[model samples]
Target: MSSINGKTIWVTGASSGIGKSLALKLSSYQCNLILSSRNKEELLKVKELCGGSNTISILPLDLTNHHQMEEIAEKAISKFGSVDMLVNNAGISQRSLIIETKVEVYEQLMQINYLGTVALSKAILPHFIANKSGHYVTVTSLMGKFGSPYRSGYCGAKHALHGFFDVMRMEHEKDGVKVTLVCPGFVQTNVAKNALTADGSPQKDDDVATQNGITPELAAKKMISAIEKGKFEVYIGGKEVKGIYLKRFFPKLLHKVVLKSHVR
Candidate 1:
C-alpha cells in the first residue's frame, strides 16, 4: 500500500463524484486502473478525464447485483492480471426519518451500501489471501459516526460498513491485507440530489450544507494519500465531523449547542 504506481486498482463507482476524482488522481500516478459503475457513458467520460487512455479501463457494473459481483472480479482479474487494491466506493445515500422511511427503502440502502460492499470484498478476499498482499479502501460518511436528521437508514448502512470492515482488517492483518475506512462529512457531489427518500424516491434537490462542502477533487487527493500510507481510519471534512468528537467528550454543553444549531 506504500505506492500506487503500476499497481492494479479496481475502483467501483468510478463514473462520478469522489470515485471519478480518485480515478483521475490515481491515473496521474501511472497506476493501472479498472473503473466500474452502472453508467457506461459516464464511465467513459471519467476515463477520458483520467488521461493516459492506456492506463484506464471501464467495466460498467451495478454493485447491488450480487450475482454479477463474481463476474466483475473475474473480469477485473482478466483485465489487470491481479488487483492490488479494491476501492469499495459504490454506495447510495438515504435521507429519511426512521419512522417515515419504508422498510424496503432501508433494505435497499443496506443492500447497496453495506451488503454489496461486503460481497465484493468477499469475492476479492481469496485472491488477496493467496497473494498475501492487498488493500481495501472504502468511502463511508460522517453519518457513519454521527446520527443526523432525516438520515437514519443512511447512518445504519454506513455504520454497518465500519463494523464489518474493522473486523475484516483485524482478521486479515496477518495476511498482509490492509483496510482503510474513510469518513467524509460532506463534499460537492451529486449524492444529495440522488439520495433516497422515505419511499425510495430521489431527494431531487440539493441541500445548502452539502452544496457548500469541500470539492471532490480535494477529497480525492487526501484519500489517495491515506491509502498509500495504509492508514486504518481517517475523517475528512471542514469542522462538522470534528464536532462529533466534542459532542462525545462534552455531552451536556455539546447537546445544548447542537439543539440551537441548524442541522435540519
Candidate 2:
C-alpha cells in the first residue's frame, strides 16, 4: 500500500460529487491537490470545504475544449512541479436510445468522455515518462463493460477508454506508469442531471438509485485504498455493480434479468 501524504495529485471534475469528496479526503492527508472543473465558483467552494488552503489549488478547466488541454496540462504541472497522479474523473453520460439519439449527441459524448481524457493523459505522458512514475485513476461506469439500454453512445465511449488505457498500461509497465479504471454503479452526483439526452439536451437529473448508492466520501476512501494497493481496476458501489461480473459469466441469465429490470 502507498501513502497519499505529500503525493502531488490532480483531480478533474472537482466541482462536485466524487471529485469534490476526493479533494476533501486528500486534503486531510496533507496531499498537494490541484482541482479542475468547468465551474470555477463551485470548485472554490469545494476547495474551502477541503480545509487546506495551503495544500489545495483550483484551476478551472473544460475537458471538452480539445484545443485547451495542453494549456491545462501546463498549468497543472507548473503548480505541482510534477504530478505524481491524475484522477481523470471528468465526463458526461448519455441516457437516450440509439435510434432517438442525435449524431451530435454521440459526438459530444465521445469528445468529452473519450477524447478529452486521452488528451490529458497524453499531455502528461512525457512528464511521467521522464520521472519514471505516475498513476492514472479514471472514473468509468459499469456500463462500459455491460451495455445498457438507452446508453449506446455512453457505453461506446466508456468501452473505448478501457481499450486505450489498457494499451497504455501494457506499453508503459516498465516505465513505472500505473492506471486504475474505476467502474462505479449509481453514484449520487450531478452527472445524471448533466447526462446527455436524445436531442443533446441535459437529462434533468433523475437518479433513482443514487439514494442507496455509497456516499462520495466513502467512495473516495475506497478509491484511495485501491491506489495505495496499486490495483489495476476496481468497482465501487452497492451490489448493483455485481452485474458487471455476472454479465460476463452468466450472459444469458443476466440478459433475461436485465430485460425485466427497471434500470432506465
Candidate 3:
C-alpha cells in the first residue's frame, strides 16, 4: 500500500469539482493537504470545509503560469517539510469543432493542459528524487487515449500528457517515484461549462452527459483507491470506460462508435 494516510498530498484545482471532493475525502485520512487553485476565496472555503485545521493549507495556483511552478513547488515542500504526492488535476477543457476553432485556442489548450502540467511536475521532480519517493496522480480525460470530434485540441493535450508521464515513469521508477494516470469518462463537474469554445470563450453552459455523470465524490474515492494500489493507469466511469479497450484493439470500431455517440 502507498501509505498515503500519514504523508502530505498536494492537489491542484482544489477549489471545486473532483479536486474539492478529493480534498474533503483525503481529510479523513489524517494526511497533510495543500489545496491549490486560481480561486483563493473558494480555496479558503474548501479549507474551512475540511475542518479549517492546520493540517490543511491553501496555495492559490494558476497552471498556465508555468514559470512560477518552481517557486510554488518550493513553497509547497516547505509547508510540511516534504510532499509525498502531487495530484495534477488542474486543467481546462474544450468544446469546439476543428474547423471552427482558432489556432489560439489550440495554443492555449497545450499551454494550460500539457506544458503547464509538465512544468509543475518537473519543478517537483528533484525533491522526489532526493527523497527517493513520490507519486504523481494526473486526472486526464478518456479523450487522452483516443481522438474526439469536438475536443480536438483537448484530446491532443491530454494525449501529450500520457506520453510525457509514461517516459517520466520509465526513468523515475528506480528513484522510488510512481505515476498514476487517471482517465475519467465523466463525473459531474463544471468541465463543460468552463470549456473553451471556438473563439476561446468559455462555453458557460451545462452539458447533459456531464450533468448526468457520476458524482465528483465518487470519482475522488476511486482515484484515491487507484493511488493507494499504485496503479500505472486506471479508468473510471460507466460504459464509457470500454472505449479504452476499443481504442486499443479495435480502433476503427471505437472511432465509429464515438462518431455515432456524437460526443460534444
Candidate 4:
C-alpha cells in the first residue's frame, strides 16, 4: 500500500486544474481529504467526483484573506483530527509586460501567491510541530526558477515560495516536517485564461504552450510519486523544464533563446 493511502491531506485550489486532479487521484488511495478553494460549489462537485471509501470534506478558502488563515487551519485540523499534509496549490498567473503592469497587480500577486501561502503555512506549523510529522507540498512554476517575458509579478511570487519553503525545510527537519516544491512547466490548465493582463483583466484566452501541455492527470501522478518518495523538489512538463538547467550552466545562451522564443 502507498504511504499516502490512509493519510489525511488538505489540498487548496481544489476547484479545478491540478488541484482537482490530485483530489481525484488521492481518493483512490483511501485518503481522508480536505479540499479548499474560493468556490464551495465547485469544491462540492469535486468531492462528489471523488466517490470512494475515503472521507472528503470541503473547506472554502480565500488565500487572499490572510487574516483568516489561522482560524481556517484550526477548522481543517478539527475535521480529521490531524492533517498529514497540506498542499499549497492555490495561485493566480500573470500575462502582462512589466512596463505596462500596474503596481497594484504586483501587490495582488504577492498578497495571494506569496503572503497568503505563508500565512496558511504558519497557521499549520504548530500542529505539525506538536505531532512531529507533516508535509508541505507546494505547486510553484517553471517561472519560479527562471524569469520569463510578461510574467514578472508571477515569477516573483513563485520565487518567493521557493525561498520560504527552502528555509522551512531546513528549520523543521529535526521536527520531521518535510517540504516539496513542485515546479510545473505547463499542464493543460486554464491558468492562462485566468491570468491577469496589464490592465488587471483576465487574458480570456489560452496560450499555445499551455494548450499543448500534458494533462493534469499526468502531472498529478508525477507529483504523487515525488511526494511518496519524500523528494524535496520535482519538475513536471515538456521542454520548458530545460530552461532551468540552461539557466544554471548557460545563462547567456538561455537568455538569447528566451528572447527569440517570443513567449506570450
Model 1 lowest lDDT segment of ten: 255-264
lDDT, each prediction: 0.87, 0.87, 0.94, 0.95
Candidate 1: tens digits of C-alpha lDDT, residues 1-264? 348887999999999899999998888786799999999999999888887488789898887888777888888888878999999998888777888889999899999999999999998899899999999999898777766778888889999999999999999999999999999988999998999999999989888888888999989988987987889888888877776687578767665665666664
Model 2, 38-119: lDDT tens digits are 9999988988888848678888988788888888888899996879999999899888888888999999999999999999
- TM-score of every model versus the real structure: 0.95, 0.96, 0.98, 0.98
- Error (Å) of candidate 1 at residue 235 is 0.7
**Best-fitting candidate, measured by lDDT?**
4
- Superposed by TM-score, candidate 3 places the C-alpha of residue 201 at a distance from the truth, in angstroms, of 0.3
Clashing pairs in 4: none
Local error of candidate 4 at residue 212 (angstroms): 0.5
* lDDT tens digits by residue: candidate 3, 1-264: 346878999999999999999999999887999999999999999999999999999998988898999999999999999999999999999999899999999999999999999999999999999999999999888999988788999999999999999999999999999999999987899999999999999999988889888999999999999998899999998888999999999999998998898777
Residue-level lDDT tens digits of model 4 in 1-264: 799988999999999999999999999887899999999999988999998343999999999999999999999999989999999999999999999999999999999999999999999999999999999999999999999999999999999999999999999999999999999998899999999999889999999989999999999999999999999999999998999999999999999999998889
**Stretch of 10 with least lDDT, candidate 2:** 205-214
RMSD of 1: 1.6
- Between candidates 1 and 3, name the one with more favorable TM-score: 3
